[model samples]
Target: MSTIKAVRGTRDLLPPETELWNRVEGVARKVFERYGFGEIRTPLFETTELFVRGVGEETDVVSKEMYTWEDRARAASEKAQSLTLRPENTAGVVRAYIEHKMDAAGGLRKLFYIGPQFRRERPQRGRYRQFWQIGAEVLGPVSSGAESAVRDAEVLEMLASLLDELGVKGWRLEVNSVGSSTDRPRYVAALRAALEPVKDQMCEDNRRRAETNPLRVLDSKAPEDQEIINGLPKIADYLDEASKEHFAQVLKALDACGVAYHVNPRLVRGLDYYTRTTFEFTVPDGSGLGTQNALLGGGRYDGLSEMLGGPKAPGIGFAIGEDRLILILQEQAAEQAESKMDAYIAPVGVEQNAAALALARELRRDGLRVEVGDGSFRLKKSFEAADKVAKAVVILGEDEVASGNLKVKRFATGEQRDVSRTELGAYLHGDQ
Candidate 1:
């Protein structure tokens, strides 16, 4: 019989590597919490209409990549409902915000989440069908100051801090204002006119986008289309005065906080809801991500709440591609010292197996990482196993168990010592 394998586009994350994942999540929790964000977990799937109404039907995530199916009803009277595995989390987050009426709480809802998100798009390096994202959202009623440029700047600053704390090197922040909902229509109109003249020369995707969602043409990554996209109308030129001021304030705060950024006029991210401010953090080539170098991207979506059938709530958020992030960390080859077992208890003989386990228990209870070896193993085999995973090996025998004295050998210097029962813990902790 053939063995079953992991599904395509998904793989298990084994140990040592999982240590890095844990580290990233641990740092994210610490950093986000310090900034007054609480953790949240939402369902992996939601009603298909939630995304259709929230992320927009025209966006590629909703139209092309979603993993959706009809969930059959249990009863004859019940109707089947279309459910989709979330392609992106922002829409679902806004849905949660609306359903819970978090606005009535009268304060900004600062929530962060770390979980897997599904998309059926073709998988590649750092991109997968089942992927992980570490993201946060800050939204609330207009009175909560959620729409302030300060909030935008603060979110950006917090991201900068997060990447720095994570040891991500040589990252660049690109910022732009796509203008507000009121201003976007005017810009989209201008973009449409500009595209009509040159749309035929662009790639097929951009040509279609020019008709369906002209703003997406600005986000094209085709090498042949760069010159054309560059020549297209810049969003900055069409920004209304309020949008210009809001963007200027965001930049000013970034500068004041020593967080650097470049103003890229063409950075109208792939989302339809982004208004006023859009930003992305990217790493240079050789970060193991090839052309897809974005560490994270998000923007100010002032109308997302109302778009999802909720009260007026403005928000800003970002989602870090955690798989891509770990790739970069691996490429950097950062020195992550393996966590060593503090002590390996090597039973001298089968008679001492119980004693060895009892000693291991005591050491473990004292907050030390202890491993116990089988008493049946030869001393040479025991030492070999201990040397690989532990900092020190403690020899346990009938004589030593009775005397409460043990022979401990340091793996590093080949140093050996006779440590008493009470002193073993301190000795393993490096007092020796």
Candidate 2:
């Protein structure tokens, strides 16, 4: 028998890769905080109805990709409750907001989350069974359609600024508006009529989409499917007056922020909840990891809360795949030098172990990150190990301890010198 490996669609982020993940996460946190969004965590799994209602029953995530399971606790009553490993964050966040009465908080409630989500599907590059998303949602008091569009532009601008600060290049933002339910159905009819002629020529997936989700057929990437979709009616052309005004406001806001964006008439996102103002950020040159390689995407879901049995609260948000962002950062980092470490502590003799440990703790307490050497290693070996991750190594030996001093070795220059015990901390800080 063959040894089993990680499930086909999942991946392990090991050591150096984890470093990149941390960097990307740090950037996300910093950017989100600047926009006044606090972090919120929801359970990994939620009751199945959340997705069934929030993400439409007709969507691929609900009909195909969700990882659903039975709650065995009610087995005695033969009443097994259905649960699903959350496929996305928005529904759970909204559920928590409603359950906790956050709407009563009286202002815009901004929340962000970073965690893993599960989906059951054939995994490919940039698409996984288990993946991580960094998401943010702003709910409450975004009453005017103009305000909603400004908020959308703000979030997208923040995201774009983050990528720019991190040195990521060659990305493009695609924007669209799917219109309200009132306007969308009419547009769907027009789309169906336009597609009826070539429906036979479309791939099987597009064919099924035509009957179930005609808008999704526009999202298909298969070359022939793209050709068929190109000739189809654009959603923007069929938008009602209110929907057109809403879309115009969103684009005007994007322009005010100097955010570069292209209007994509056929950019209907995968989920069913999306209404007006749908957008996606992608690497246009195709140098990223995934096919079509969208780095982030989202849209307004004005009716989702009400659909899920909550009040009529409208919300808008976006989710970015952290793994994909890290992969992109890794590719960028490869062209640059690695980050430097702060300090390393090499304790020379068993007799001086306690003293070295005490000094290490003191340095850490003073807010410096110090890595101590294992007592089993000799001074030279320990210094060699320290050199790999440290700019300077503190060598604590019996002779140095007896003299109330320590040897401060600078790794980059291969220079060694003695410092008085009281001055050791200052010397290290100065060197740093």
Candidate 3:
């Protein structure tokens, strides 16, 4: 028989690593809840039209990276539908918002989600075809202040708080404004003209982007194209007065909250929906993410609701590259020791195995993490295994069971003690 393995670009998340993932999610939930955001889980797959309409059809995510298929009709009267695994989540979130008619109640909807997103791109380092994201979106009708610059700053400040709370150091915040829908066409026209002559001098990808989506050309990281990209028309120069004021207000609010940021004129971001403000947080090189160090990025999409066939709802959101975030944390904690269980129960003999199991159950019931060893193992082997997996080892023998006391040894301190059965839970719990 041949062995089957996980598909390329998809890998298993085993123990210890999953522990770190849990910690990150727990912290994210706490921080998001503190900001009045509730959890929202949308389906992993949606009608392909949802994305084609929400995320522009010309965007790389919708064009080249999507995992799409045509779902067959189950009945003669049923029609086939085009389905796609979500490459990004904001579109789905907005789809859900529109589907549920959430705006009918007339209030801002602050929702967060943590889950897997699929993108069929060349995987490398922290980039994967199947990756995890921790993201949030805030949207509502115009009357609810959802379009206010305060909302943008509040979201930015909340992200700053999350990174700091997670103990991530040396993160940089880059901000920019891509202007509103009315201003976008003008800028795209300007960008098109600017790229006409020099497009041939750029990389193949940039050349394609120049014709399809010139704004995406600014997102190119090809070193050979940097010189030409720098000379391209800045989006800031084309921004209308309304967009300029909106960006200024966002920056002012960030400053009032003591959140540091750098304004990058060319940071248009790679999303067609982004309008007014766009931002990204990045870590320094050598942070285990190599050259792909963007921790998260998002921007205001004032017309996303209407674009998705819903009422006029303005919104802002960001998606954290959780896999990259974990990589950075692991690099930072490289020297830290692995955590161990509270106690391991080692049976002195095969005859004491039953008794050891009973004791383990009791300890576990009282909230202690207990691991049990088989009585067949030799005492030395038991000690070695216990030392590796647990902070303390409890010796289970005929005499100890009969006397109602357990022989315990602390691996770290090498101290031995006799703990009564009634007090074993407290001792294992570090109450002693």
> Quick one: best TM-score, which candidate?
3
Which residues of candidate 3, in runs, are more than 4 Å off? Answer: 75-77, 334-339, 346-352, 378-380, 391-432
lDDT digits (tens) for residues 284-395 of candidate 2: 4455674667888998888877787776677889999877777676665642333445578777767767877888888887776687787679767997888877778887
| TM-score of model number 2 | 0.83
Q: What is the clash count of model 3?
A: 0
Off by over 4 Å in 1: 338-356, 371-432
**Alpha carbon RMSD to native, model 2:** 3.7
**Pairs of colliding residues, candidate 1:** none
Question: In angstroms, how far off is 164's CA in candidate 1?
Answer: 2.4
Question: Which RMSD values do the candidates have, in order?
Answer: 3.1, 3.7, 2.9
Q: Give the candidate number with the greatest lDDT.
A: 3
Indicate whether candidate 1 or candidate 2 has the larger lDDT: 1
In model 2, where do residues sit more than 4 Å from their true spots?
1-5, 14-16, 72-78, 141-147, 165-167, 284-287, 334-340, 346-359, 374-384, 391-432
Write down the lDDT of every candidate, Cα atoms only.
0.91, 0.81, 0.91
Candidate 2: residue pairs that collide? none
- The Cα RMSD in angstroms, rounded to one decimal, for candidate 1 relative to the true structure is 3.1
lDDT tens string, model 1, 364-428? 99888898999999999999999987889999988899999999998888999899999999898
Which of the two, 1 or 3, has more TM-score? 3
Report clash pairs, candidate 3: none
